[model samples]
Target: MAKTVVITGGVSGMGLSASKLFLSKGWNVMIADFNKELGEKVYKELSSKYSKKQVAFQQTDVSNATSVTDLKTKTSQLFGKVDSVINNAGIFTKGALHEVAEDAWDRIMAIDVKSVYLMTKAFVPDMIEQKAGTIVNTASISGLTGDYNMAAYNAAKGALVNLVRAMALDYGKYGIRVNNINPGPTMTPMFKANPQSVIDTFKKASPLGKLAEPDDIARVMYFLASDESNPITGENIPVSAGFEIYSGQPVQK
Candidate 1:
């Protein structure tokens, strides 16, 4: 049977990379993203190279329940069924807790934490009915530990990690596996938004001596969603190139 996977934020960055990888693995991809422009472009680009039936694009606002509901409906109509879902939509907020605006914190929670809940609420039932499925959440190194000026991002991702654990506990009996992928300083648009000095410092400090590529994280996501990782559930797999080993050390850059 052909597998189907839905990836939120699938238009760019790791999400886009994962989308492509999923297709190459013989799974149909429903590219769900808030960026309509990128979404359509990816859909068209992939359609040009593969069977149109193997790919789709849906503009999704994962933070909004109504939007997610509609996304689920349309995705079902287009793909018939979904075998896995990657909650990869997220935003970055930088500032001390005391200085961060309340709105910024809420936005982070909505897109990062609440979006996971909404995706689960909307998709888990179908997965339960099928009795076999996987859910992959995109967390961050900030979730495992913390970074300066990232109070909102850290809190939201921390909640996301715990949520994966809770989901695994509740749904394991139904054969549904839930896991989190914690990426470190990947070269995504989000990271590129930072100044070059900031980027250089993080790259030099990483044990790998460079920021991770989107494909680096995408491969792990694919593995977790594949049968190869059937025994692994509720695991927080860090793909951060040893960022945790010396998170306390300052890069001399």
Candidate 2:
């Protein structure tokens, strides 16, 4: 029997690429996103390309406990036992500490951080019972390092890095692996929304002279979910084109 995976935010960007990758690899994919229209559209598109039974979609608000529970129940009904869960749904916020709105901070924290807690709670029990599972989180380089005028996003992602570590320690004995992928300025719709100067600056800063594509990030997600990385857990691996490796020093001619 083929394995099954649940991917939040699976309608677009990196999540959409991951959904495609898993389906191509013969895994049953549950595409969960907040946009019902897009979810159904992508569901139809994917169903046309692959086995209709191999793909499913659910309109989910990952930040809410009730919505997440509903997603878990739906996945169980549609796919039986989930072999993997990808916590890839998140919103980005940017502002100085004092400039950040209270509601904005609350929303970011709830979506980026609390969603992980809710997902683990909802899915890990069946994983524990089966004695195996994989959990992949779509974090950012901001989680591992600080950025100017992005206090809320940085804090939320930073919390996720440590949370993955704590979860690995708690769940390692149960033969489950938990990891986060800290992508560096990928060419997703979210990143492309920035001004051209902003995009150029990020690309120039990267040693490879380009930002990552969604497929680039999705490939690493696939690695963490595959048996080749069975011993890897609690890793905040960056798929950024050596963007985080450069020091702020000026390039000498």
Best by TM-score: 2
lDDT of 1: 0.92
Candidate 2: pairs in clash = none
Residue 31 shift from truth in candidate 1, angstroms:
0.7
Count clashing pairs, candidate 1. Answer: 0
Write out the backbone clash pairs for model 1.
Answer: none
Cα shift from native, residue 9, model 1 (Å):
0.5
Model 1 per-residue lDDT tens digits across residues 77-130: 988878999999999888999999989888989999999999999999999998
Q: What TM-score does structure 1 among the candidates reach? A: 0.95
Q: Evaluate model 2: give its lDDT.
A: 0.93
Model 2 spans with C-alpha error above 4 angstroms: 250-253
